[model samples]
Target: MDLKKVERVYTSYAGVYDQIFGKVFHEGRESAIRNLNVQPNERVLEVGVGTGLALPMYPRHCRIVGIDLSEGMLAKAKERSEALRLTHVELQRMDAGAMNFPDDTFDTVVAAYVVTAVPDYRKVVNEMIRVCRPGGRIVMLNHFRNGNKLIAAVEKVISPLTKHLGWRTDLSLSTVLEGTTLHVARKQQVNPLRFWALVECVNAKNGYVVLNGAAASYANGNGAAGYAHGNAGGHYASEHSV
Candidate 1:
C-alpha cells in the first residue's frame, strides 16, 4: 500500500522475480486468465501486471493492456513483451488507483495477485469497475488473510514487514470489496495449499453479489467445502473448485 516502499522493494526484484515466484504462483496466473475465456478482438485490461508474467498466456487476438505503478516491474514486462513478440499486449507504468482511461473501456479487467499491494485497494477496484463495460467481467487472483486465529495472529505480527515485500499478508476479501460494484460470481481455489483464490464476476449496475457464505474461513477449507448454489431468477452462491 505504501507507494514509495513498494517502489523500493521491487526496484531490484525484477531480475529475480521469476526464479522466486514463477513456479510457485504459476497456476494462479494461468487459471485466472483461463477463467476469463476471452473472445477474439475483445479489449482487456490487466492491473498490476508484475513483470508481465501473464502476458504470454493472454490470447493474441485480444487487445490487452497491462498497467502497474511500479516502473521496476513494467521495465521487465516491456522486455518480456518484446522477447515473446506479444504484439497484442501493451505495458504501461501507471497508478492503478488513478487510472487515466474513460468509462466502460474494457470488456474484461483482471488483477492477478495484486489486490493488497496498491495504496488504495478500494480505489483500484473502482477504477477497474469504471473501465469495464456494463456486461463485462472483472476477475481477481489474490491471497487474503487466513481465518485461523493462529495464522491471522502471525500475519498481524509480520504485517509491518509486508511493505518490504510490496504486498500485505492480512488482506480480507471483504476489505477489498468494501464499496465495489462487482461481485464474486465464481471462486476457484488456486495453488497447492489453496491459499490463493481465483474470483470471477460480472460488472453489474447494482451492488456486489457475493455467493452465500463467502468468507476467508470458507476458502481456507476450515468451515465448508466450496459449492455453488443458484437462487431464484439469477444468482450463484460461492463455491470452491473441484
Candidate 2:
C-alpha cells in the first residue's frame, strides 16, 4: 500500500472520523483499554491513536504517549485530550513502522485498528515489541481475515477495493504475529457483528526467558488459550488481566 495515499485518506477522515467510526468501534476500543489493566505510574504507548477515541477511557493514574502518522488526526486527539483535561497524555506525529522511542520504553503498547492500515504490518509489530518492556502487554484490536473458507475467499477478492479506503481486510492474525517476539495469550473476536479481533500478547523479546509467570505459562502450553467469539464484553482466558 502507498504510504502517502494511506495518510491522505485518514487525514481527510479526521474531521468526520469520530462521527462515522466512533460508535461503530466503540466497544472494541473500550474493551482494549479496560482489559489493558494498566497499573499506577506505569508508562503506556498508544500507536495510531486516531482522534484519541480511547483517550478518555484510560485511567489517568498512568502516563500515556500517543503517536500517529496523520497530523490532522493528532490535532483532533490533542483537542480531545485538552477538553478532557487528561494531563497525563502526550501526542506526537510519527510513523508506526518506525517509532522514535528507545527499547523497553513502555509498560504497555496498544494498537487499535492499526495493523492492516500500515504499509508493513510486521515491521510495525516489531517496532511495538521493540519499544515495549519485557513481559509488557501488547494489545491490538483489528479485523483479521475470517476463518471460514468462504468468507476468507470473499475478503481476498475485495481486499484491493478496501485498501483504497485505508485498510485491507485480507490480513490474518497469525500473519501479523509471525516471527515477532509477541507471545499472544488471548485472541478474541469482539463487537460490531464480532468481525474484529482483540489480540492480547506478552512482549517476550529475547525469548521466553524474559517472560514472567503469566507469559511463561502461555509458552509452556499450560495456560488456557482459546479463540473467543462474541462482543467486547465477552470473557476469555488472559495472562495480563490483573
**lDDT values of the candidates?**
0.75, 0.81
What would the per-residue lDDT of candidate 1 be over residues 127-189, giving only the tens digit for each residue? 899988654678889888888899988887887788567888888887777666666667778
- Lowest summed lDDT across 10 adjacent residues in model 2 is found at 217-226
- For residue 162, model 1's alpha carbon misses the true position, in angstroms, by 2.0
Give the per-residue lDDT digits (tens) of candidate 2, residues 1-242: 87788889999999999999999999999988877666667788999999999999988978899999998999999999999999999999999889899988887899999999988998899899999866667889999999999999999999999998999999998888887877666777888799999988767665433322322222112222222222333322334433
Give stretches of model 2 more than 4 Å off: 210-242
Q: How many backbone clashes does candidate 1 have?
A: 3
Q: What residue runs in model 1 are displaced by over 4 Å at the alpha carbon? A: 206-242
TM-score of each: 0.83, 0.87
Backbone clashes in each candidate structure, one number apiece? 3, 0
Model 2, residue 40: displacement in angstroms?
0.5
Candidate 2 backbone overlaps, count:
0
